[model samples]
Target: MKYLVIGGAGFLGSHLINSLDGEITIVDDLSTVKYFEKKPGINFIRQKIENFETNEKYDYVIDLAARPSPEDYINHPVETALSNSIGTYKALEIARKSDAIFFYTSSSEIYGHAEIIPTPETYWGKVNPNGIRSCYDESKRFSEALIMSYLRQYGLDVRIQRPFNVYGPKLREDGSYGRVISRFIYQALKGEDITIFGDGNQTRAFLYVSDWVEATKKMLGKGLKGTILNIGSDKEMKIIELANTILSMTKSESKIKFLPPREDDPPRRAADISKAKKILNWEPKVNIEEGLKITIEWFKGVLN
Candidate 1:
């Protein structure tokens, strides 16, 4: 099988590429990645998905290009919006022509401040269209709509996967753009203040990257077209508890610093993975503590 992977140089894409056994081509501008070592026996194109032009045919077209970091999207909203809206269109066009199965990696952030505890794919979501995080949230929502339209109108084989708070090795930990787990681990390792926004009661369900990659490969391998799956761990965790865990694991002497709540930050976020379990017959295997231990070791290697 042949595959075209957009944004295949980032954290999730890098791991996904390692699991594939076929001719592969990765097209990415490297805007969100800091350091990605190119793998052998694959074609790499250094360009944005929106502007990339390709006539090659493939069996699969996977679009994972987007600025997901709250800090980065909030800072560069226009780029984020275009990456999903226009970028998704370009990927769809490629899949349409190549007659390939298309897979889009959407986010759980589409459910902004969700009223439901474990959000299912049936939920329409209550996202803010004009908020600070809308660039990332609304754009993902729009991309899902666009992908559905392509499936309905053009008979394109398409699949959508919404992933909750995924983190592990190769996750960005350089600065403010890092997600909660990466940021906390980096702070703990550096002996800096572990900052918590709001009252530290906000909760999130995190899936380790390896488990996520396993589910993704299964979805692409066996999932039918027009199917949407929510891939994540159901285990929920509080921010304060997460901070304490990281501090304890790293044995760092960093105090917890409380800050004002972030704009449009969700009070609680978790996934209802019943559909994924029934359809893909998969569930996350790694618990939070074990996942964190491995992640911390990866960060320590980078530090050394």
Candidate 2:
């Protein structure tokens, strides 16, 4: 099988590429990650997804392109928005023409400060269109709509997955672009203060990369077209608890520092993964402790 992965250098995209087996082609602008070295049966095209052009039809065309981190998106709002909107359109068009199965990696951010505790795919979501995070959130929502439209009008085979707080090895561990788990792990490992933006009561469900990849492959293998599923752990934990756990696990002397919350930061997030279980027969296997231990070990290597 031949596959096309856009943003193949980013955290989730790179992991997904490694998980797949086939002749794989990667398109990335290298804005967030370095271009990987050439390898057999793998081709890397260093370009923005919006500008990617090809006549080769693929069995799978996955779009994981976007400024996924809040700090990154807020800094490059236009790029983030366009990456999902126009870039997604380009990918969908390719899928439409080639009759390829298109997979869109949406986000749990579309749920905003969700009214539902464990937000289901059926929930319409309560999002602030003009909020700081809307660039990433609303654009993702738009991409979902675009994909559905194509599915409805042009009969494009499309699958959508909303990943909630996916973290593991290879996650960004630098600057403001890093996710909470990686950032906390990095700080704890380095004996720096683990900063908590809000009151530390905000909650999130973390899914390890391996678990996420496994579920994704299962979903793809099932060939469920025009389906939206949540890929994440239902095991929820508060931000403070996560930081404390990382500190304990790392045996670091780092102390937790509380700061004012950033604008539009969700108070809580957890995925109702029943749809994924029912449709794909998939659920996350790695528990939080095991996932964090593995992640902390990986970050130790990177930091050292």
Candidate 3:
């Protein structure tokens, strides 16, 4: 198998590359990665998506490259938006020409404020167009539009997976861009206070990296053909409860610090996985407790 990962050096791409049974090829700018390390079967080239020109054909093209950090968007909005939009356009072009299976990693952020609990695939999301995080969220939403357009017009095989709060190894925790998992876990390990951007009641489902990668593979293989799926765990946890869980799991002395609610953060986030389960026969096997153990181990190695 021949596979091409656009952001192959980043968190999700690195893990996915490790699991794929293929001659893996990677194109990425490892400038932002402070803790990135190379792994096996990966032919990596330090390159950006805009200048990434390759004649090599691939059987699969998985695009995990994008500026997914809120800090990036705030500091360098232009560059962030470019990486999200133009970068995706180039990768989809490659997938189209090669007739390869295209897998795009979308986010659960698109579902801004759910109209119902456990949002199904058919539910139209409620997003603020002019919000602060719109650069990241809207760019991803536009990327999805591009993929669907290609699939519809050119008959390309494209798979979309919207994963929620994925956390594990290779996370960027230099206080740059990441969800609560990496930063909170690091602080909890060090006995620092955990900061919540919104009220402590905002709920989210954190999927382990392993589950996310497996679901991506499955979706690439069998869930395409114009099927958009939400890949997330249904186990919801409050922001405060999540902090407490990390504190308990790591045996840390970190205290929860509440702050004013941030703009556009939904009160609760939970996915309706009936479509994913019925279609791909995929469900999260690892619970949060087990996932945290694995994640804490990784964080310990990083901190040490």
Candidate 1 ranges with C-alpha deviation above 4 Å: none
TM-score of each: 0.98, 0.97, 0.95
Pairs of residues at least 3 apart in sequence or in different chains that clash in candidate 2: none
CA lDDT, every model vs. true structure: 0.93, 0.88, 0.83
Q: What are the per-residue Cα lDDT tens digits for candidate 1 across 21-97?
A: 99999999998896578988999999999999988999999999988888888999999999999999999999999
Best model number under TM-score: 1
Query: lDDT per residue, candidate 2, 122-144, as tens digits?
Result: 99988899889989999999999
Q: How many angstroms is residue 48 displaced in model 3 relative to the true structure, after the best TM-score fit?
A: 1.9
**Candidate 2: global Cα-lDDT?**
0.88
Weakest 10 consecutive residues of candidate 1 by summed lDDT: 171-180
TM-score of 3: 0.95
